[model samples]
Target chain A: MPVRVAVDAMGGDHAPGVVVEGALEAVAEAGDRLAVLLVGREAEIRAEVENRGGAEDDRLRVVDAPEVIGMGEAATEALKRKPDSSIHRGIGAVKAGRADAFASAGNTGAVMAAALFGLGRLPGVLRPALPGYLPTPTGTCVLLDVGANVEVRPEHLVQFARMGAVFGEFFLDREDPTVGLVNVGEEPGKGTDTVKEVYEALRALGDRGAIHFVGNVEGRDILRHGADVCVCDGFVGNVVLKLAESVSTILPDLVRAEIGRQGLGADHARTVGGVLRGMLAPFDYQAHGGVPMLGIDGTVVIGHGGSTARAIRQMVLSAARLVEQNLTSRIARALADDDAPPHP
Target chain B: MPVRVAVDAMGGDHAPGVVVEGALEAVAEAGDRLAVLLVGREAEIRAEVENRGGAEDDRLRVVDAPEVIGMGEAATEALKRKPDSSIHRGIGAVKAGRADAFASAGNTGAVMAAALFGLGRLPGVLRPALPGYLPTPTGTCVLLDVGANVEVRPEHLVQFARMGAVFGEFFLDREDPTVGLVNVGEEPGKGTDTVKEVYEALRALGDRGAIHFVGNVEGRDILRHGADVCVCDGFVGNVVLKLAESVSTILPDLVRAEIGRQGLGADHARTVGGVLRGMLAPFDYQAHGGVPMLGIDGTVVIGHGGSTARAIRQMVLSAARLVEQNLTSRIARALADDDAPPHP
Candidate 1:
């Protein structure tokens, strides 16, 4: 059976245009194996589809979602105020089982709020979290609670560890991914009271074979890929993600300014800039695509507001993979067996 | 009178060699206006001074500090165990009025612990914090509590702002430097429970003209230079600082890898790498020198463990400036009347 995906076409900075093109691309690539419900203003989506000249696919259906919640709107107020918004309607499809997964590049808060209220949390989960995919030199690592629970208890962190590990296994396609608690130091007794408690809990969880908890990791560890899954409170995680996102822009600007300062000719500068961009390709958000709201009862991925057509296409594929992998059930089972004694 | 500065010659990775060279440079430049007390193993300090030639400077004195504290040792325990360590002796010089200021490139925790116990806190200060200098496109911004006070309250953050502002004014040489609270979102209401309270306190303080509080700033603000001083609890600040420090190394490596992948000739790669290194000069900790532990009763600066001769020289010069400007008194006065109504 085809795994149907709902796309928030009205969401994102370049909404409808890139979203439509991306949905069309996913439908074309996946053929009959995947079906996309483009949820947004039908007229705008149709116009975008027509502009792209690929409107004849049966697998791609434009489902009318008249309202549009802005990128900066308050999640709860916007969702309650605009019931027909793309984020709401898109998530509604997942809740109703019309679509196996939901994806959006809209307001991250709204997407998360919608997922929580509509899909609810999986069993054995304390709090849901947004896991941002960071591209390290070694490959990719997951930094969770990127914008979810701003204040998390020790138990919430333990839950994040289990969920993050499962997601890491799928994303990295590696067994026994290492989980780390992001802190000021790598020692066991480091960090705030909450982090200390979480560290011990994670240690206990590791001993039980539920996860490969690799002690504590500092901020540099994220880029160093010291652990496959790095977890922290949403407040810290969000700040780190934003800073990392800005590095792509800041680093290149510094390089360009340097080239100018060195009095390099325009021709040489162009070649150097090209090489620099190629080198920084790994930092591209479009390549990483969407971040999944882990612990949700169903698959729900949130992309950057400035997502390109390529990013949207990648998010759609990622959603399909999560569905096929039965992420929610796997996470539930992992948490359920967390306390059982290790098999002999 | 000349400003007397105590240098922790046994601290940092390079130890006596770089410390001696840097001290000599500072003394030579400052001439009779500066005096340096090199606190470490007397024999080792003398050997390094002789190895570098120019050992006839009368302003540089070698003070014997027989004991040493390893960087990885527990801060409080090490400080107690190694009473004769360079960090302890350096701060002792400042406390005893033999030195006007103290500087160290040793274990950061050890330096902070020694400063707190030795010099105590300025009047009205809630807690002392470490302010890390970050180079931006415009100039430098200070991020405080970089590794001190990992868990802080609203009042502590307010104190940080007042102290950081005083430091920023001197460091940036700009009157009324802007102070920003590092948080997940730019909105005042966004962040953890502690941050929300801090927002209100900072706002009230700003309204009274205690500081030029710029509401909230995200992680990107450090490089964006959104504010002259960005404040956060030590836990978050330390993480951000370390991650930013890693970028210098990571970015250069990525460029080299890209050059190799592009099949660029070795000659071309070397030239490009040189240009890249020059471009990244601002990020060099050596140029920024030491991070001052603010709110302390005396001027105490801590340098990176991997500091070079240039960085040590800068730290010594920085300590002189702090003493000359009476930074401790300025911060003390800033927080003393923080609650007083605005002048008519």
Candidate 2:
């Protein structure tokens, strides 16, 4: 009855070492409720698993993958050429019903392609979205299409909102998540023609109790977490995500240097620096491993290329939680209900 | 002859008090090189100016404006109805050649409308952009059309890039400022159709030695000051601007809270907080008083609604600097040159 998560052991920056370590950690921490399928070069992954003190019980398994998708290679190209890649094999396991979910710290494009091609998109879901959780000054908020669908239509945005709402309900435990369309301004007539149309659609959807729509939210609101779910085209969402990460990295370092120049005591300076670092550290996607490709037939979490043991552990844990909560099923049901016409 | 700047004394959140204080500060700091024409309710401004401990010096004068523009009113409506409003009067003074520039911390829309109507746009300049100096992680960079020209064409974007370049040269003192179009990606075929066309135009302009065109830059590059000037439609630019401000405000608070819970000394915490605050403080546009509306016939700096005395002082100083730099003339020359067809 343990939630089984298939992890691409050869897919991340830290590779077998971090993936193995993370799997062990997840299994240990999750007790008997979590199982991990380490899919990679059999001999290498086996050695790594043994190095990490071996699996606690039958809750762990090793699936061999002959190849890997490089971080720099085009994701779609790599998926076609490298069918035996660990990321591909891992996703296959989930689709084949060998694993409940799949997690990878590999190329995002490859993971998305593999998930869509391997498992397929759910009903009424035109495109899958990479939904990311950003910690804001007020609280944490979810942003969809962080990098998944680059060119999206009004209908795509509607689906993203629905998927994001479902994810938030399962993860953040928010009842009737307040959904907001990320726009240039809060005004109704702001942004491009696509945004305007989407705004109208979202407004209509909200009126019918599909979701608790909060209307349009500006860029600053992305970090403010003014709404539980924030939906935008992948281009905008990706930009927002990258910018927030860059700011988190650069601003704190600048602040620390400035503070150090002021001749603050070493102990105090380090403590303050530590505090600032912790506050910003979460923004680094490596810590969260990867983003989840929502609206797919099965749960798939994409990790960053530079993910480490801790990040991988978090990814595994996230995957298990997604499966346990039956997030995909809930999202599919919502989409189905949305597609159905209203009765008078 | 000292550069004269008209101040809308009755505008902004801390109006009259802050505006008067800032004007006096600018006059005192700039010595005889600058003069301020404070336009507002004559009695209120005089009382505030008198309370500032400086006598009615030769460099400072007050003009009577019976009405004031409210921040909530639409810009076009406010400008059309309140002809004798403080902002309108200040702009009128510039039009009448009584002042070299006009500065206001009133409603941005109103100030923009008044400037366009009174001062008029320069030749070859389709729209006047509101450019602000955003303090990035690397250094300060210029972001154009933060809220000006919301619906922009490819031609408008080219103009924005040119205007931003001029701004960088005048304020940042860059000899050959590098200009970039803010897009979702750095690839040649990234972003929406609008951005792609602008990219091609910029490339063509860059080849002619008009400006150092740096191709496309993502949101992360904004705070990095990757280029001297960052150009985008008003919507995207405004989003970036507001997001940066929000991050600047929230990041410090998060750090402070963490440090506080750790029971760090107040002085040490303040030191850390101060550094974080300082990095973000420059973005407090109100602190700097006003931002110049580049490419206009005369100088115009739009201040924040929450402007204080210090902000007004900074705005006054900025206005004087713009006059000293001959920003408007330089912008006109650049625009004329840019509009010319390339040589074989």
Candidate 3:
């Protein structure tokens, strides 16, 4: 059976054009293995799908959702007032069992609100986390609670570690992916009381051979590929994620300036520029498609606000993969199976 | 009339050799305007000075302190155990009115301990902060509380903004440097209770024109030049500093890989590689020399653990600049003049 992913066609900067186009691409690429439920205003979505020559495709369906959620509106307030909004309708499809997953690139808080209110939390899941993935030379490093929960307790961090491990094992295809608690220093007593307590919990799990805990990892290790999952409070994780993205954007410009300063002729510099562009192509967030809202009852992948057609396609594909891989069930199992101590 | 900077000769990975050699370079560069007090074991300091050809310079002085603090030693524990340690002796010079400032590349916690316990906090300065500077394309961004105060209150954040402004005006040479409380989001009520309170306090300061407060800035803004100074808790600031440094280090390799993927001939790729190396040269931590510990009564610059002679020289230069500009008095004035709300 094709995994049906409900996408908010009205979401993100690109809107119906890129979102509808991306769904078409994902459907075409997956052939019969994937179906997309485009949740948004029926008129724009229908026009976009028709323009893209996919109006007749049985795999693509448009769910009429006339109301919209503005990017700047308060998420919880918007959720209550705009029940017919794309975010609400899309996630609602997942709750109603009409779609296996929901994906959006709209206001992050709105998406999180939709997931929390619409689908509710999974069994034993304290808080849902936004797991942001950073691709390195060796492998990918997953940072959890990127923005889902700004204020976190020790147990929440431990839960994030477990969820990250399950996600890593499934996505990276690694056996027993290592978990590391992000801290200022690698020492045991480095961070605040919350972090220290989390460290002790994770460390105890490692001792019991329940998890392959790599102890404390500093911020630089986000790119070091030292561990499969790096867990921290959403505030820290969100900051690191944004700073890293900025670094990727700034690095290329710095490289270009250096190339210009090399005293090379314009033509030669242009040639080198093409090659360097190809090198940095991987760092593009579009390549990863979207970040997953992990630990929720249903799968939800959040793309960048400025998501391209390909980026939208990637998000749809990610959602399908998660649904097919039984991500939610596996995460639930992983959490339930764990015998680690709770908050001290 | 010379500004004397007491440097921990025993600190840093490349110990007495780089430290002594750096002091020699600073002496040569500063002429008679600056003097360096090398604090370490007398024998090693003397040999290094002789090797660096600065044995004849009267501007350079050797202060004997045989006790050494290992990089791995617990800061408070080591401070009590090794009273004769270089950190203690170096700061002792400042306390005893023998040196105008101090610089070290040793264990960060140990240096903070020496400063707090030996010299104590300046009047009205609740806590001293380790302010790390990130060099952006436009200018530099100062981040405070990188490690000095892991546990920070709202007042501490408000105070850091004042100190950062003074440091920026003197060091970065910016007129009325802008300040931003580092937050997960740009919205007013986005983060924890503490962050919210800090935001309100900083916003009020901006309104009063007491400080160039830019409200809340996200992680990506650290290198955006949107604000000259970014304030956060020690934990977040430390993560950001290390992560940004890692990105700077990792960006080049990623770029090279990107260039290699273009399938260019070995010679052309080599040429491109050389250009990139030059481009990324500035991102090197060694280029920045050292970070100044702000909000203290005395000037203290903290360098990286793996400090080279060039890095050490930069640290000394930074310390000299701070002293010559009378950074302490300026910070004290900035805080005393502020009309911001106290901690709730």
Candidate 4:
């Protein structure tokens, strides 16, 4: 059966336009292998599609989703209030097995709330995690609970590690992905009680070949490519994710300042900017498209609100890959094993 | 009385040498204005001092503290087991009224532990915070609970704001520094119950000029120079601190990659490197020296393990500024006020 993916066409900064463009791009690239259901206000979605020339591919379908959940709206309240929001309706399609996956670039909390309430949780998973990738010189590192379940239990962290490792193996195409528990210090006894317990549980799982535990890693290790996957409570993970993002925000100013410091004029600086842009491509957040909301029963990808058409395309493709690999089922199978260490 | 500052000469990675050089540099710059007590193994300190020539001024003192505490040791256990460690002894000097402030580039947890047991908590203070400076092109921003109290209550966060605001005024030389509560999102009702309550408490206090609350700030708000003082529980603060530090860690390699992409030889790249380093100097972690351990009874500065002689010098100068300003007393007075809002 062709893999079906639901797109939140009303989500993100440049919503219907970029989202529609992205869905069309993915269909063209994936050919008959992929089907995209653009879910949003029917009129807007149609107008966007018509603006870009009618949806020429039979694989592309527009589903009427009348409400739009804003980027800054309260996730739970908005989800409950706006039943027809692209996020809600799109996620509902995945829940009902009409779509194999769901993707959005709107409010992260709303996307997660939709996953929790609509698509529902996977077997043996208490809290799902939003896992994002950070570019490292060697490749990429997986970091989760980036913005899902901000207040997580110790056992929730263990589940994140198991799920993150499985995701990493398929996503990064690596075997027995090494998992590191993020903490204040690298030593075993450094962090809170929750971290200590999670470490012990991960260690137990590692001994049984369920995961590759790399002991403790600090925040610096995430970008340093220290492990295949790094797990932490969403609070800390969110801060790390944002802080890494700031590096991009500041670098351009630094380069401009450097040109000024060297007494180079605006024209000279603009020429230098082109080269610096190429150099900075790896640091761009949009390159990754979106981060995945894992531990849910269906594939769900949440991109930044300012996502570009290219980023949307990347997000659709990523969700399609997870769907093809049966990532959610793999996570469920891993968490279900009796040999898996019990959460604290 | 002349302000006496105790230096942990055997603390950081580049101990004795950088620590001694830093102390000497601070004394040379301050002349008769400040005094530094180099506390560590007397023989090693003396040899290092003599190697660099005996103290140039009487303001520099070398105290005999025979034991040393390693960085990775558990804080509470290390403090109890090694009373003679420089961290314990230096803080003790402050407690005994022999030293007005203490600075260390060693173990951070050990420094906090020393402040808790040695100097003791200030009256009306529950948990202390470590406030550090993040340099922006415009100026510097203050981030507290950097790594002091890992887990904290809403009241402790309020305390952090009061303390951090007072600090930014004297340290960054701002009047009524605007305070932002570090959170996942900037909206009114984002984040956990603890964050929401802290927002209300800060708001109530802001109405009274207890703090200049600017509402919630997301992770990206930091480093963008969003607020003067940003407060959060130490766990999230620590992650932000480390992730920012990675910018310094990775910038060199990134510059190298860019130069390689430009097809420049090693010699040309080295020349470009000198210019880039000059531009990147403002982003250097060492430029700020050490962050202060605020809310304790005495002045305490905790620096990075990878501190250099210049960093140590900056650390000494920073602590000296706090001692000169009577920062500890100001914080004590602020917390003692009857109108101070109770923890939510």
Candidate 5:
């Protein structure tokens, strides 16, 4: 059977327009390997699809989800208020096995809540986490608990480490992925009491070859790809994710201002800007698709709210890939295997 | 009397050489307004001073401190291990009223420990916090406690807010600077219990005109200069500081690689690199001098370990300014005046 991705056509800033376009692009590219179920208001999505020269293939179809969740609505409350919301319905499609995976750029909390309620957590999973991919000069780094559990214990972090490793190995297609605990200092004894315990646990896990643990990595290490997977409490991880994203826009603006100051002429400035933009391509959040909500029973990817058509397409394809790889079950097995005494 | 800044000549990565050179530069620029007491091994300091073509003014003097603390030494233990170390003696000079302020580019923990042991905390101050000046496109943003308190209660954060405000207003020359609490999200109740409590307390204080509290700011707001002062528990703040510092180097390297890929000629690449560097000048930690360890009884400035002579000079001058402005007492008064029950 083809991997079917349920795209939230009413989610994100541009909503139906970009979402429909992106889904079409994904279906066209994936051929027989992928199918898409655009979940949102049927009329709007269909019009958007027709406007984009229409999807000529049968792999693409619309699943009507009338209720649309606003970005500002509180998650749990919104999920209750709008059961047929695109975010809820999209994930529900996955829950019903009508679609292999779900993807949305809507209210993150709502999507997470709906996923937790509908698909439920994988067996033995303590908490589901949001992981964002950070682009480094060497390669991509996976940072987990981006905004899932603001205050997490050592156990939650350890689970994130295992899940992140699985994501890196399967999704990113990497060898034995290295995990690093984000700390204020690089030393083993550094950080809060919770982090200290986490260090010991992750280190113990590393020794047994459950996951490749590289010990403590400071914030500077995140962008440098100091480790394949960087784990931290959701508070710090969320802060770091947003901070890293700002660099792409902020740095380019700084350069452009300087170019103007130097009177570098229009031609030279354009060339310089083009080169900088090309370099920052990897840093673009929209192009990379959705970040995964790991530990869920089924595939769920959350893209940037400001996602372009390109980002939406990437999110659909990425969701399809995660379903094919059976990331959810892999995570469940990893957690269960780690349940044995780490010291033994 | 001239504001006397006791410089730790035997501290920092460069040590006596750059320290001596920076002191000379500061003294020269300040003329009779500032005096620098270089504390280190007498012979090494004198040679460095001579190597810099000697100091012609009596404003510069060398204070012999035979013991030198290594960068890797434990903070509290190192202070006891090296009684006559430059870091200890420099702060000792301030404690003994021989100098108005103390500045070091050595081990941060050692400097903080030394300052705490020697000068002690200011009246009404629960913990001494370190604040770093971040270069924003608009103006500098003060972030604290960079590495002081890893875990803090709501009360400690309130104290940080007051202290950071004082630093912003007095040292940064801002008019009633706005303070923001860094969190995962921008909403009032969007973080851990500690942060939520902090938000309510700060809001109350803002209403009472204790300090200009601008509500919660996300990490992306940091570089955007969302607030004049950004406050967080040191764990997150330290990570943010390190992450922000990495941008100058990482972004440049990315651009250079892209330039190579685009096959831009050496001359064009050089021009682009130069422009990028010029724009990134404010991001340079060395140029901005030392970050202040606030809530201490006396002025204490902590410079980067990798500080160059220019950075050292800036640190010395910054120290002198802090002394001249009586920043220590100002912080004390800010905290003391805030003793009234916030709600009442």
Candidate 6:
């Protein structure tokens, strides 16, 4: 059976239009193995789908969601107020077995709230983390708690490491993913007390074959691909993500301007832009469509509130892949074992 | 009435060679307005200084110090053992009223340790902070505690903000330096409890017209001249510094490589390198020689351990500038009456 992905069609920056286009492209690329459920104002989505001259096939379906959660609204508040919102309805589809996984480029907080409230968390999972993939010279690395949990305890970091490990193993297909505690330095005594404790815990866990712990790594190490999973508090993770994004944005522009002065002409400029974009594109989470709220019982990927149609489509494609890979269940199984002792 | 600076002749990566050359350049540039005391092994320094074939003047003096501090040696331990080290001797000259300020491209920890032990901290300064000037598109911004105190409290952050504000006002000559707390987001309730408390404290302090507090700014804001003085704990500050350096290094290479593929010749490549280097070079703190340890009673600037003679010379020039500006005393005066209520 093909993997079914439920997308909140009315959500994101270019909702319905970009989302529909992205879905068409995703379906075409995914062949017959993927199915998309565009859950939003059915008439509008149907009109857009039909206007594009793409035939309605068994792999594509339109489900109605009358309401929408605004990007500016609080996640929990929006979820409670707008129960019939497109994102909520889409998650409900996953819960009701109509779709295998749900993805939405709506309010992140709302999607997270809906996923946790609707699908619930996995056993032994204290909090669901937003693990983002950072592209490095070697390959892609994961940085957990990109913005999901504001205040995470030391135990939360430990759990994030575990879940992130599973993500790298499944998504990026790495064996024994190297995990590192993101700190100021590589020294054991470096960073806040919370990080220090987490470092010890991670080391102990690694000894038991939970993950390949690489000890403390610095910010430079994140881009150097020093570790497969970089674990930190939500605050630090968010800072790192934003910093990387800013650098990626500014550096390319500076380079382009510098190159333009030499009269390399249009062809050279476009080539440089394309190469820079390809290198930095992975950091743009919008292009990835959504960030997976890992460690939940069911598959849920939360997209950026400012996401466009292409972003929404990517979210749908990612959700479908997560379902096919059985990522959630695999993460749950990894955390269920309680044989390891707590490190002092 | 002219400012005098003591340069550690036997310090840094390319010591004696680069240091000797840079000092000659500094002395020649300043002319009769500045006096530079070269502190190291008298014979070697004098030989290097004389070999440069410059007119002999009373403005430049070679102070004898038989010992040298190895960059790899433990900071405090090295200082304790080598009482006659060039860095220690240079500070002694400042304490003894022979030089206004001391600059060295030696061990940073040793410089801090020596500054504290030799020169002492200002009246209410809890700890001396290493303040780094980061170049931005708008201009330059000062970030304090780049690598001074690892474990910091809310109170420490408050003090750093104060010191950085004073430094900015005096050195950068900003009338009211806008101080910003570097956090994950601009939202009031976004960061960790520590950051939240610091934010409130900064707000309270800013309300009193003591400093222009710009509330919370994100990581991206750091490089955009968002605030005149961006304050954070040493751990976070160090991360920011290292990340900036890594990006400056990696991005140019990536750009050059991509441009090379378009058959851009060696001349064009060199031109690209020159332009990018000019823009990114200012952000490389290592090239700037050393960072000043603000809040100390006397002037102490710690240069990179791998700093060459060029860096050492720059450190000497920077130290002279700080002394002329009366950086330490000015910061002390500003922080003297800061008894405002702690932020909630």
**Per-model TM against the reference:** 0.96, 0.90, 0.96, 0.95, 0.96, 0.89
lDDT of 4 at B306: 84
Candidate 6, residue B228: lDDT: 89
Per-candidate count of clashing residue pairs (backbone under 3 Å):
0, 5, 1, 0, 0, 4
Better of 2 and 4 by DockQ: 4
Candidate 3 per-residue C-alpha lDDT over B73-170 given as tens digits, one digit per residue, 9 for 90 to 100: 99999999988998999999999999999999998889987888888777788889888888787767888878777788889988888888888787
lDDT of 5 by residue, A140-209 (tens): 8899989999988788888898889999898568888999999999988999999999899998888888
State candidate 3's DockQ. 0.72
- The regions of model 6 sitting more than 4 angstroms off are A41-47, A50-58, A207-209, A256-287, A337-344, B40-58, B62-69, B74-84, B260-275, B278-287, B338-344
The local lDDT score (0 to 100) that residue A312 gets in candidate 5 is 95
lDDT of 4 by residue, B116-150 (tens): 87877788888888887777657789888877777
* Candidate 5 similarity to native, TM-score: 0.96
Best by DockQ: 5
- What fraction of the reference structure's interface contacts does model 6 contain? 0.35
Question: Which CAPRI category fits model 6?
Answer: acceptable
DockQ for every model comes to 0.73, 0.50, 0.72, 0.58, 0.79, 0.42
Tell me how far the alpha carbon of residue A299 in candidate 5 is from the true structure, in angstroms, after superposition. 0.9
Residue pairs in clash, model 1: none
User: Clashing residue pairs, candidate 3?
Assistant: A279-B258
Candidate 2 collision pairs: A289-A303, A290-A302, A290-A303, B18-B309, B22-B313
Residue B10 error, candidate 5, Å = 1.1
Stretches of candidate 2 above 4 Å error?
Answer: A41-47, A50-58, A186-197, A277-287, A338-344, B50-58, B265-287, B338-344
RMSD versus native structure for model 1: 2.4
Name the lDDT value of residue B270 in candidate 3: 74
Q: Positional deviation of B85 in candidate 3, in angstroms?
A: 1.3
Taking every candidate in turn, the Cα RMSD to the unseen true structure, in Å, is 2.4, 3.4, 1.9, 2.2, 2.0, 3.3
lDDT of 2 by residue, B1-344 (tens): 99998988888888888888888888989988998899999999889978878666668999999999887787787778878899888998999999999988888888888899888999878888998667765667888878787678788888898888888887787798899988877778777888898898889889878889999988888888878898888877777788887876676578876777677787767776666666565666665567799878899988878777777888889888988988899888888773443221
Ranking of candidates on DockQ, top first: 5, 1, 3, 4, 2, 6
Q: Give the docking tier of candidate 2.
A: medium
Give per-residue CA lDDT, model 6, range B52-155, as digits (tens): 88544588888999999987677778988999999889999999999998888776777888889998889888888888777776677888878788778888
How do the residues A94-193 of candidate 4 rate in per-residue lDDT, one tens digit apiece? 9888999999999888888888888778888888888877777667888888877678788899999999999999878999988999887787876787
* Local error of candidate 2 at residue A279 (angstroms): 4.1
In candidate 1 the C-alpha lDDT for residue B145 amounts to 83
